[model samples]
Target: MRRGGAETETDDPTEDYDDTHADGEAVTEGAGARRARLRRGRRDSAWTRALESRRVRIGVAAGVVVALAVALVAYFSPLLSVRTVEVEGISAITDQQVQEALRVPEGRSMLRLDTDAMAQRVSELPKARSVRVQRVFPSTVRVTVEERTPVLYFEAPDGAHLIDSDSVEFAIEPAPIGVPKLVTEHPGGYDAVTRAAVTVMAAVPPALRLEVGQIAARSVSDIRLELRDGKTVLWGGATDSERKAAVVVPLLGQPGEVFDISSPNLVTVK
Candidate 1:
C-alpha cells in the first residue's frame, strides 16, 4: 500500500502471528487477559440418584393415595361411629335424660365428634350446672353433668321452684324434704331482698337449716327466719352474716322466742 510519496514502504498484514507457538495456547488480542475458574466436586450420590428414579416417584404417589383412602374410610365408616353413650355425675337429672339431652348424631365417627356442641346441648337442661362431654373411643361417648343444688324454694302460681346458690331458678319440683321456703315480697329471681334472704339462709348451720321453716326479708337490710318450732331470728342484711350466724346459734341455746343477731356484737333476745 504505497501512498503519495516515493519514500513510503508497504507493511505485511500477517505479521502478528508467531509460528513457534502451538494452537493449544491462546493469543491475547487486548492489553489485559483473564483466566476462567472451574470448581472441583464429587459425583452425584445415591440420595440424589434415588430422588430422580421413576420407581421411587411412582411409590411415593401410591403411598399418598393409600393414606388418603385410609383417612376417608376411617372418618366415614361405621366402625368408628358412636354406638353407645353413657351419662354420669348427676343426681337430679337421670342418666337416660342426660343422654337424651346430649342428642349426639347417631352413626357419627367418634374421631369427628364435636364434644363442645354436645355439651352445649346438654347444658340446655335447667338443672345442669356444668356439663362435660368426652369421647370414650372406639364407639362410645360419655356425658358428665353436675346438677344444681337447691338452697331455697320460691313460691309460684304453678308450684315451688328451686333456687341454687347462684340464685338461679332451676326446677319447679316439690321443695326438698327440709328445704325452707323464701318470702321476699319481691317475687322475681335474684331480687335484692331475695338475695339477702338467700345469704342469711346459707350462713345458717346445717342444724339450724333443718329447723328453718321459711325465710322472710322486708328489705335488703331486714331479713327474718321463722323456725319450724315457732321461733324467729332477726338477721339483718347480707353483710356480717357469718358473725351473726355464730351469735344466733349459741344464743338459741338460751330460752328466747326472738333471737336477734342483727348486730352480732350486741345481740338481743325477746
Candidate 2:
C-alpha cells in the first residue's frame, strides 16, 4: 500500500464492453417496438377498410329501399289515379255508350291502366272504324274512336246491313236516305259482286251518288247502277272505277237513256 504513494485502481476493460452491449440491446428493443407499432397500424387500417366497405353496402341497400318505396308510393298515389274517362271522336255511339262499353276501372292508377287492352275493347264496337286510347296525366283516360260510315245498304234476310266503303258490313239498321241499295244474290262477304258494287259506289262523286237509287250485280262482271231518274249505268267490273266516275258527269250532259261509261276509254251514251 506504500510503495509508489498512489497504488492505483486497475482499469477494467469489461466495463466498456458491457456498456456497448447494453446500448446495442436498447437499440434492438427500440427497433422491435417500432415494428410492433407498424404492425398494429396495418391491422387498424385493414379494420377501417372493412368497416368502410360494410358502410357502403349498407348505404346501397338503404338507397334501394328508398327508391322502391318512392316507386310504390307513386304507383298507388291518387295523383296518378284515373278520376275521369273522356270519350272522343264518337257520334253513332254516344260518350255514355262508349263509357259503358269501356267500363274503365275508375279510381285505378293511370300507370296500371292498359291502353292497348282498352283500345281492343273499344274496337269491338260495331261502328268503330279505328280506335285510340290515351292516358291523360294525373286523372283522366281519353278514348278516341273513329266511327264507320255507311257507303251503301245491303239487304240480308235478317235485316238491312249498313256497309262501309271497305265492304265491311258494320251494322243492321234501316237504310239511309242517300246511300244506294245494293242488291246481290249473296248476302255476305264472299260475294265479289257486292264488293264490286260497293267499290263503284265509293268511287262515285257524292253528288252523283245522291241520285243513285240501286246497284244490282247478277255476277261480278255484270254490275249495274240505276239512277233515281229512270236511267242505268252498266258498270262492267270494279276496274277503273275512278276513271269511270270522271267520265260519267260530262257524258250525262248528252241526251241519253243509258250511259255505258264502264269502258271509260270508249264511253257511249244511248
Candidate 3:
C-alpha cells in the first residue's frame, strides 16, 4: 500500500512529457502568430509607401501636362492667322497699288505685320502726300492716304509740271480736271512770282479758270493774262488778288480787247 501511495504521488513521466510538449507547442504557435502579424504589418507599410509615391508622381505628371497645355495656348493665341486689308482716302492711287505696297499676304499673322515698314513703303509713291496705317485687331489692317491735288500747271522742259497750292511740285504730267494751265516766261522757275500767280489764278472764279489760257509773270509787279477768246488782261501785280479776280469777272462779261484791273480802286478797258 505504501509503495502504491508513493507511486501515486509521483507524476506519470509520459503524461508530464505530453503536457510540456503541448504547452511548448502552444507558446511556439503564439510566437509564430505574432511574427506573422509583424511581417504582415511591415508589408502593408511598404505597400502604403509605394502607393503614396505613385500618387505623388501622378500629381507631378498631371501638373506638368496642364502647364504645357496652358503654355502652348498662350504662345499661339495672338498670332495673326487671317488677314484683311482696307484702304481709305485714296483717289489717284489704286487700292490694289496700296495693297501691294503693304506687302502683307493672306493668312499672315497680324502680329507679324510691320506697320512702320508698310507706311514707309506707301510713302515712296510719288502721289502720296501723307500715309497712315493702322491695325484693326483680330484680322484687319487699315491704310489711309492723302493724295496730291494739282493747283496749277507749269510748262517744264519735259512736259507740264503739276504744282499744288502749297507750291510743292509733283510731276510733269497733263493737267487734271478743273485745273488751269498758267503759261509763263519763266516756265521752270517755281519762284515767288509763279506762286503768286497761281494764288491769283486760284482766286478767279471756277468758271473762268479754263477761259484764261496763259498767265505771264514778266516780273513780280507785272502779271499779264492771255485769254482764250483773243483778249488780254494786264494785271499789275499780286496785290489784292481776290479783289482783282472779282473785278475781272465783270470785265469779262463785256466784250473788250484788254481789261486792266491792276488797281482795285481804278479799272481801265481797251
Candidate 4:
C-alpha cells in the first residue's frame, strides 16, 4: 500500500512491541536516577542540620562556663578585702584597747583574720571574759566583748581596784558602781573572801545592797558585816551563805542593833 509520502509494507507487530518495551525501560531508569539524586540531597541536608545543632550546644556550654568562672572570681576576690571594723558591748575597756587586743588592723583581708586567735587575745584583758568576732561580706568586721562584772572594791598596794569573782583585779579610776567596799586587816582577805562575798551579796535582796556599808573578814571564820546604821552583823563564817542571807534580810526588817543568822534555825538579835 502507498501511504502519504511513504511506501508501506507488512507491519511487524512483535517488533513494535519490543520497541515500546525498550522505551519503557529507558524511562524507568531515568526516574530511578532522579530519585537517587533526591535521596542523596536529603542525606546531605540532614548531616548539615546535625552539625549546626552541635555547634550551638557547644557555644551555649562555653558561655555558661565563662559566666561561672567570672562569678566565682568576683565573689571571692572582694571578700578578701576588709573595709570597716565595728566594736560592740565594750564599756570598761576602750575601743582602742579592744582593737589592740585583736591585733587585726584595718584594710587587712577578712579571710586572713584568725577569729580564734583574736578571741584568745581579747580574753587576755583582765576585764574581758568572753569575746566574739564576726565578718560580714564586702568588708565589715564586728567584735563583741563580754566583761567580768566586779563584785567588790579592794584597796591594794598599787591602788584601789575592783575585784571580780575570779579574784582577778582591774584598776578603776572612779571605782565601780553598785559594788560594796571591803575592809580587812589582812590583804589576803581580798583573795579569800571575795568569792564568798559575791555569793552572799547575790543572795541578798537588791533592797539590802545599798544598806550594806562594809564587809570585814579578819579570818576565814571571822567574817562580819557593818550596816549603814552603824550596827554590826556577826556572820561567823561563809557556810550556808544563802540561808544566812535569807534569815538576815527578814531580821533587818525589824529594828535591831545586831542580828546573828549563822545558826540555821536560831535568830539572835541585840
In model 1, the worst 10-residue window by lDDT is 33-42
Error of 4 at 96 (Å): 1.5
What's the residue-level lDDT of 154 in candidate 2? 78
TM-score against native, each model:
0.73, 0.74, 0.61, 0.66
lDDT of 2 at 76: 78
Q: Which stretches of candidate 4 lie over 4 Å from their true place?
A: 1-79, 105-107, 188-190
lDDT of 2 by residue, 137-231 (tens): 86888898999998888777788999887788899999778888888888565568878888788888777889889998888777888999988
Evaluate all candidate structures by whole-model CA lDDT and list the values in order: 0.82, 0.82, 0.77, 0.73
lDDT of 4 by residue, 49-158 (tens): 99999999999999999999877665456545667779888888899888888887554567667888888898888789789988887677788888887766767776
Clashing pairs in 3: 80-109, 80-110
Tell how far residue 18 is off in model 2, in angstroms: 43
What is candidate 3's lDDT per residue for 1-270, written digit by digit as tens?
Answer: 158456444453223222246447532235456567789999999999999999999999999999998766544555654467889999778998898888885665666677899999998887888899998976889998998888778876788888876667877788876576766666543587888776777676777777777787777778877878888888878778878878888887786799888897788888
Stretches of model 3 off by over 4 angstroms after superposition: 1-82, 105-117
| Worst ten in a row by lDDT for model 3 | 11-20
lDDT of 1 by residue, 1-270 (tens): 456665664365433433344766656432121111111112345556766796888999999999999989889887899888888888888887787777777777887888998899889999999999988878888888888988899788999989888788888989988888988777556587777777777899887999999888899888888999999999888899888877778899989899888899999899
Better of 1 and 3 by lDDT: 1
Candidates ranked by TM-score: 2, 1, 4, 3
Instruction: List ranges where model 1 is wrong by over 4 Å.
Output: 1-70
Which scores higher on TM-score, 1 or 3? Answer: 1
